[model samples]
Target: MFVHFDRPVPGWEPADGIRTLVFLANLAAQETTGDTASSTSTERLVHRLVGSTVHDVLALALIDDLPVPPGSKLSDLGYPLVPATGDDDTELVDDAEGFLLLGLPLQEDTGVVEVEFILDAGYLPIPGEVLEAEGKHVIHRLLAEAERVARVIGRNTLQTWLLHSPDEPAGTGEFADLLREYGYLPGLTEIQGFVDIQSNIATTAIGESLPQDASLRAEIIRDLCVPEALIPGLIELYRLASVEVPHGSLDAEPVEWTPRRLHQAAKRVVTTERSMLSVLLIDDSGVIGLSEVTCHPGSDPDVLEQGITIIHPRARGRGLGLLLKRELLHAVATELPAARRIYTSCASVNSAMIAVNEALGWRVLSGGSGWQKHLPTV
Candidate 1:
């Protein structure tokens, strides 16, 4: 006699009817995944937990259903009731089955909400037959609700996320087929990784930076800190670098970059204090290279996720990419010392970047698909 319903964030009704889609991870999958006991995942779970967007929330519970935190709102995720920290949270965790989250950057363009889901490889054959009836079929419900919400928001696409880890968990292939069957597109494949930013490997590499005469300065973008006058420089930057970014497929259309898009992106970063965008400028050229590492919305304060790193073609071959990274690493230590781990991902096809990551002590954690750097705070 199980019935399912979504609880709206209190005091936050969707005037546009784009109420959040609540998806529950059944940690106690009595009928599915054979993970009825209780399982915590670092792969899929960490990425979702790494960085947070302006509008996000991740509520965890021990029950079969998702827990919606009290006083939750679309504008903010109420003070996170962190696990393993205080006695007050014991009651909160004990009350629910698992967690529910409203995650990262909604499509400002289309109003789509995005989320990633994964299961441990050790768990085979996600018991679709047994739980489909218990909770309206978890995966199917997510897709249907996503679609329903997308339609209400007046958009046709529900650009939610679906990641494929290298481990190729037992049921992943089947799950993806089901996703594609449900109208989801295979948009992009990303590698998840981490590295020790303070390790001997990275310190040695940073030491190789060109002497002080190099005349390159790195600045992390903050609250409209990048004057409008400098926007064009970043625009020119996109024109030269975006073509190289890995995309949907080898034959995919070239990304159409625009100055307005660059400005819009820079403006969005200002909304969050934790987001970091490090730009390198040479004395002669306006904007030569840049790197962006955004801390996840509800991510551990000690970590930030890689966003973008690009060096203009004219500035390449001189190790500017390495320089940009080295200097940005300095920014992390001095400016964001409390931050401990830095994770960046790239496509398997990007060998050059992969090589650079290897040199910087970044190891691929997700079956050799992405790189992660562990930044030692001390």
Candidate 2:
């Protein structure tokens, strides 16, 4: 039997936290080999792998408490473990043979919630063998719980659920077939992009200089104070640019942004050492182009994750998106020279951004599609 903890990270006991960290660490070890898997210097690897979850939990908690921000509700389910009690203590017994981590998004009625699931490397059977029954059972239970959450947060019944995996395996792969067996239908595709900063610095020099248009200006916003007047423009730009990009499914909506939501996002950090950086192209009208990235100095200082890069519709044709992106790259290189790689995700249909990424020497690491299922009316 599996024990579930619905509480936030701060609520979890030390033992519970340790169990989850060890499970994640082992999972990483399984996925890696050679020097990475070697126990000789695994402390850093474990910190990086397990630290990610901790950061996410803290970031989620940093959002405002009432009227939860859109796309901020995340319910996590850890691997199954037997619960045990001692004379003076309580702890989880991790003698179990399988592991799974599921993160489910609880959205509004008629909205889509994304499902993120991971399994122990061993549980993945080769071509013909049946999928592990234990992992399958855990997934079902998690989905049921997700449905209950959606019902509570939503109107009456949950509407649509989404899952994403590599596009190549969606139709014919074993894992894809398994998801299909349940109720998921393949939907929009996404492209994963990666760039090695050190290698591309020379090629992306245009970013070395700011936008040249006399009417336009650029600035990098970090932990500095945000101007009061520009907040509304930033919110509007987000709404316009984000909606224009394809989300999970055709019906999926971009996150609703409010002034409060914007402030919360700007100030939130996963860890104390984590830094949120945004490169913005502004005009007398307001922010017209933007690029964002985050770095985790405490856990893994060498990797940077790209957030969003958008150019206003009116400002489109001037290569501002590329300008913002390259400028952001240079900013990161200057501020965090230790950063080695930068990662980004773009909807498969966004060829313009994809072309810009290609121009900066970013390469496609993987391709995945969002799959959705519309639940039956209750």
Give the total clashing residue pairs for model 2.
0
Residue pairs in collision within model 2 = none
Query: Which window of 10 residues has the lowest lDDT sum in candidate 1?
Result: 14-23
Q: After superposing candidate 1, which stretches have Cα over 4 Å from the reference?
A: 1-136, 169-172, 200-208, 211-224, 227-229, 238-244, 249-271, 275-277, 281-283, 296-298, 367-378
- Candidate no. 1 TM-score: 0.59
Q: Which candidate is the best by lDDT?
A: 2
* Residue-by-residue lDDT tens digits, candidate 2, 1-378: 333323323322234333443454444433322112111122222222233311221100101112322333234433222221112122332333332233333321234444444343455444346667765665565456555544554422222222222334434555566557767776677666577777666655634455556767777778423578777777887887657777645454566777876765555453334577777788877888878887643335666778778888878898778777777788778877777778677877889988999978876555556666666656
Candidate 1, residue 192: CA error in Å?
Answer: 0.9
**Global CA lDDT computed for model 2:** 0.53
Off by over 4 Å in 2: 6-93, 96-112, 126-171, 203-211, 223-225, 248-251, 270-273, 296-299
